[model samples]
Target chain A: MEVVLMDILGAVVTFLVAFVVGMTYGGLSRKITARVQNRKGPPFYQNFIDAFKLGSKKSAIHHGVMHHFGPAFLMVSSVMTLMIVPVLTHNQWFPNLNFQGDLIFLLYVMTFGPLGMALGAGQTGNPNSAIGVTRGLSQMVGFEIPWVLALVALMIQYHTTSITGLMAAQAHSGTWLMFSSPFAFVAAVMAMFGMFRYSPFDIVGAPTELASGPISENGGKYLFVMMSSGSVFTFAKLTLYVDLFMGGADNLLILLIKTFALYLIPVLYGVTTPRYRTEQAVRWFWGWPSFFGLLAILQAVFF
Target chain B: MMNDKNSQKIVDIIQNWARKHSIWVLAYGTGCGAIEIPPTMTSRYDAERLGVRGAATPRQADVLLITGYLTVKTMKRVIRVYEQMQDPKYVIGFGSCTINGGMYYDSYNTIKVLDKYLPVDVYINGCMPRPEAVLSGFAQLQKRIAEGRANGAQQYKDNLEWYRANQKKIIPNWIMPDYNW
Candidate 1:
């Protein structure tokens, strides 16, 4: 009973931390984008206000039962991903579920939310949502090749399929895997661009073109849930990358620093770039990123 | 305690505060006034600093900005868009065109009075309002939101029949979903 209660408490705390950090990062990205464009931006806490306002909205309409479950499914996936990723190197309070072969599970879990969302968007009877979902799924397929190859290369090189095992390998070696497996890191970071879905790769939900895509029909509380889930998911993905590439952080501050540094790579890149069409984006991903992934795999096999 | 008037007032206060800070505008650019929106949203005025961002659809929008003159044909679509928006929505009638049709007032097919068909929360008067005027208009909407007085959606609901009558007078063949809310 005590163990269960502790775990529950740990999960709640982990979620709260992820939520705050993720929302702040989103706000900071907006600020950075604003500054880049030579404009004054909203405060760093603006996203929080938007979330609160969305939640407080009096009415929400849904096309069907699936529409209602869409955000819930997204929330579940994000929280589940957060639970599987370790936040700190040796923290008792943040007792998350880490296990052997969890890396494979993580990949499956991350994509689960989008498929659920696609189901809901389809039920809305909106052509734009359908187009957006197809584009998003195709883009997912584009990025997944390099992402999987990078992970596979790391797993083969380190002789472990678990995220914790990979982290342990880095700790044992006294150097980050990013330094040891530079090609894998390069491939992974390149794939991260599409995964983050910032500009250039943001065709899936191109606001002007697709009417905000899959989320076009969702508003009020539904939007609120989606927004919060997105924040949690962002933090989780960033933490996963930090754990894999950088030696997993020993403390909260270090973890935040490492994750934010990794996060800036996609965000800064997105700000300066223009949007790419779905086909162009897919081809771009299959081109150089896949090549790097192949090189990573070859290097791992030889070394 | 949940139903207590004071408690509800407190909830309203909090909600109003949140709503005031985030005004997602769905600019229904019906006329040449659409030209000013880019500058307002981009480098010059930066309406985002005041939480006045552009929403892609009616579902996600809080404010329906009716920019420039609305013809009889466009008004039908505008009405449809306004009704599609969720509750607690505001409408800003922009420019002299929306107020009394501007130079198109004498011209046939242009709407002279916007409030006859839709409840407008604020009206910014100009031949074509500049980015500064648009920012000011957003500020006015924000102030009304904070005061909990921008209940244009509620007013529309309460007077749905009258608004519909006015709308139908212009749109002879009214083919629309019933105001479900």
Candidate 2:
């Protein structure tokens, strides 16, 4: 019973941290993007206000049960992923649930929300929603190859699939995987560009085209939950990247600095580039990222 | 029991304050006033500082800006879009055209007055109001929201019959679900 209670506590803490920090980072990105375009952006707490405002809005209509469950499924996937990814290497402030899962399990868990979102959008009967889901899923297929290969290479290199174990390996080696397994780092970082889904790759929710994509039919509190889930999911993905490549940070400040730096990789790339058609984006990912993934694997095997 | 009600009131106050600040306008380019929106939303005027941004759909939009003259044909579509939006929504009648049809006053197809069809919380004047006027209109809407006076959605609900009657007269081949939600 005591162990179970601690697990629950850990999950709660992880979610809260992910939610707060994640939303702040999202607002900061908006601010940075605005500054790059010569505009004064909203406050760093703007997302918080938007979330609260959305939650407060009265009236929500649903097309079906799937529409109602869409955000719920997305939120669950986010919280579950957060629970399994270790926050700090070996500290006790907020231990993760990694003992129950591994890199392979996390790979499947992370995809759950998008699939659920697609299912929900499919049921909404909106053509735009359907198109967005199709584009998002195709893009998912494009990026997952290199991302999975990069992870497979690391699992082989470290001889363990556990995320905490990977972190420990980096700590013991006194170097980030980015420095040691540079190819995998390069491949993963390239894959991260797609994961962030900024411009060129932002076809899924291309507002000018699909009217905000799958969430076009969703509004009010439903949108509120989806937005919050997005913030949480963003944090979880960024943290996982940090733990895998950057030697996991020993402190909160270090974690913030590393994650924010990694976050900029996609943000800056999105700013300068125009959007890509879905097919073009899919082809681009398959061409270069897959090659880097193969090279990373070969390097690991030889060395 | 008293604390429960008090807490609910406090929560309402906070929600109202946030809603007042973060008004997501629906991105529908109805007329020439639509051109003025880009300046406000983008680099120069930077309406993001005021916590207002464009929402891609009526579902996500808090404010619907009727940018110019609405033709009889488009009025049906606008009504449908308005009904699709969730509660706690506002409408801003943009330009003299929306207020009194501007130069289009003589045009038979263009509606002379907008308020007959939808509840407009604010009306921005000028042939095409500048971005500053648009921003000021938004500021007034926010003030109305804070004071709990921006209940146009509720007003629509209460006066649905009158609105539908007016809407149907102008729109040939009218078909709309009854206003309840």
Candidate 3:
């Protein structure tokens, strides 16, 4: 009974930390983007207010049961991924559920929310939502090739499928995987661009063209749920990358700093670049990023 | 005194506060006055700093910005869009054209008074209100929302028959689906 209670408490703590941190970082990214564009941005807590306001709005029409419950489905997937990804390197405080999953599992789990979201968007009866979903699924296929290759290379090289084992190996070697296997890190970061769905690669939900894309029809509490889930998912994906490449962090502050540093790669890149057509984005991912993934594999095999 | 009614009032106060701070305007710009929106939203005026951002659809929007002169043909579409929006919504009748059709008052199609078909929560009266005027208009709307006086949506619901009658009187060929929402 006591063990079960402790586990529940730990899980709640992990979720709260991830939620608060994730949303704050999301707001900060908006602030950063605003500053880069020569505009004074909204406060870092603006997203919180937006979410709460959206939540308070009265519920309106829905297409069907699938559309009505889509946000709930997406949230479940998001929380599942967060539960699986370890936040800190080796800490009792962060008690992540990494013990239950490996890299392969995390790779597959990340897609669950998008699939659920796509279904919800499809049910909205909006043509733009359909177009957005198609672009997103296609982009996923394009980026996953190189991303999977990079992950497979690291797994083969480290001789462990588990994230904790990989981190333990890094601790023993006294070097981050980023420095040891520069090619894999390069490929992964490039993949992260597409994964982050920033500009250039942001053809999926092209806001200007598709009117906010998949979630175009989503609003009020539905949008609020989507925003909260998105923040949590963002933190999970970033933490996974940090754990996989930057050798993870020993403390909360270090974790945040390292994750934010890792986050800047996509964000700043997005700010300066123009949008890409879906096919162009797909081609871009399959071209240089795939080549780097191949090189990383060769390096792992030979060295 | 601290009963369910009191608690409901407290909830309304909190809800009103949240609604006032975060007003998502639908990106549907009606007519020539739409041109003024870009400056208000962009770096020059920066409306986002005040928690006013553009929403992609009516479902997500709290404020419907009727930029200017809504013609009889466009009024059908505007009414449809207005119906699609969720509750607690407000409409801003932009420019003198929306209030009394301005120079377009003599024109056959231009809607002379926008409030006849839909409630205008705030009206920024000018042929083309500058970005500063637009920003102040939004601030005024926010102030109204905070004071819990901006119940235009509720007003529309309460007098739905009258509003619908007025709307149908102008739109003789009303072929769009029922304004059920």
Candidate 4:
């Protein structure tokens, strides 16, 4: 009984911390995005207010009964992402979960909310949203491959699937994994940055091509929940990336600050660049990032 | 001195809070002019500083900041959204679309002037205004709201005929889809 209670308490605390941290990261990214564009930006509290208002708005039903599931699933997927991410601490039970897996687990698990959103949008039969959904998922397929190769190379160097272990090893070794495998790091960063879907790669719900993308049909509170979840998910993904690369998760504040730095890097990329077509993003990810990621793997092994 | 300072601080906070909440806008995004919205919300324009946001649903938005000219079809949706919005929402005609139909005035599917359809709180005169123009327009509208001079949505609800006639002209056989005309 006591063990069960402790486990429940840990899970609750973990979730609460991730929720607050994830929301903060999401909020700060919005501000960073404004700064990159030479704008003063919204208050950090804006996202929370938006989310609260969205969740409070009178529901506007769309199409069918199943349409209701999209926002619910999106919220669940976002919270689950915070739960799985070892961004806060490695002192998590089932840290290895199934196998003592590495970045591969992170990669696959991270895809769920997006995939679920895309599928849910397609099911609604809104041609615009369906097109956006199709494009977003297809873009994911292209980016994920090179991202996996980059992860594999890092795993080879560290020889463990544990993200926390990899960071600890790098911290003790006195040189960041980024220094040892700069090429892979750069390739992965670019690929993942594109995956962040800020600009250039914002083809899925290309406002020009298809209204507002998959959730374009969603309105009132429903759209709000999905968008807020997406923001939270974006922060979680960035947090995971920073924790893995920067070895900054030794303390919560350090982890947060490093994540902020990592988040800013991508937002800066977003502001300065123009959006890419879906085909353009896929080609760039598979073509250039893949090539660089491969070269880095060879260099890491043979050198 | 401390009591006076505390009271002053309380007053300042309340005023700030009120200013942030009541920014009503003209919700028209007439054409391709709507493309600038992402940058306005994103890190670039960062309208959050002004507490301005794009409300997907009409009821939650205080400002209906119209972007550009209105097509007949999009005009229908715009009217629907405007009707749904609560009172105290301000309408800022973004570009020439609301001022005089701009380029779309003589176009087959465009309305000649948006004011014929809805009350305008402020007219931002530009062919297609920049984010700066839009933001400034919002600031002007906010100033009016602060002084309690603007409450256009309620006025709109009371005088529906002027707007209805314009809408009826567009949708000649105007009846809810469920109702047989």
- RMSD of every candidate to native, in Å, equals 0.9, 1.5, 1.5, 6.6
Better of 1 and 3 by TM-score: 1
Off by over 4 Å in 2: B2-9
Better of 1 and 4 by lDDT: 1
- TM-score of model 1 vs. true structure: 0.99
TM-scores for every predicted model? 0.99, 0.97, 0.97, 0.74
Candidate 4: true interface contacts recovered: 0.25
Residue A252, candidate 2: Cα error in Å is 1.4
How displaced is residue A42 in candidate 2, in Å? 0.7
Please give, for residues B1-181, the per-residue lDDT of candidate 3 as tens digits: 5568989899888888888878899745768889999999988888888889988778889999999888888888889888888788999989999888898989987889999999989999888999988999999999999889999998998999999899989999878776555
Stretch of 10 with least lDDT, candidate 3 chain A: A92-101
Q: In lDDT terms, how accurate is model 1?
A: 0.92
Clashes of each: 0, 0, 0, 21
Residues A1-303 of candidate 4 have per-residue lDDT tens digits of 977776677766655566666667666777876776677877777666556544544453456765777777777777666555675555643132223674666676777777777767877787888888888888988888778878888878777876767777877898777787887787788777667787778887566567667876575567667766776677567666775676646667787778777777767777688888778888888898889889878876777
Question: Candidate 1: RMSD over Cα atoms?
Answer: 0.9
Quote the TM-score that chain A achieves in each candidate: 0.99, 0.97, 0.97, 0.88
Point out where model 1 deviates above 4 Å.
none
Error of 2 at B77 (Å): 0.8
Higher-DockQ candidate among 1 and 3? 1
Which candidate do you rate higher for TM-score, 1 or 4?
A: 1
lDDT of 1 by residue, A1-303 (tens): 999998999889999999999999999999999999899899999999999988887555859999888889999999999999989988878987989999999999999999899999999999999999999999999999999999999999988999999999999999999999999999999999998899989998999999999999998888999999999999999999999999888999999888889989888999999999999999999999999999999999998
The C-alpha lDDT values of all candidates are 0.92, 0.88, 0.87, 0.69
List each candidate's DockQ score: 0.84, 0.86, 0.76, 0.20
- Arrange candidates by DockQ, highest first: which order? 2, 1, 3, 4
- Give candidate 2's iRMS in Å, 1 decimal: 0.9
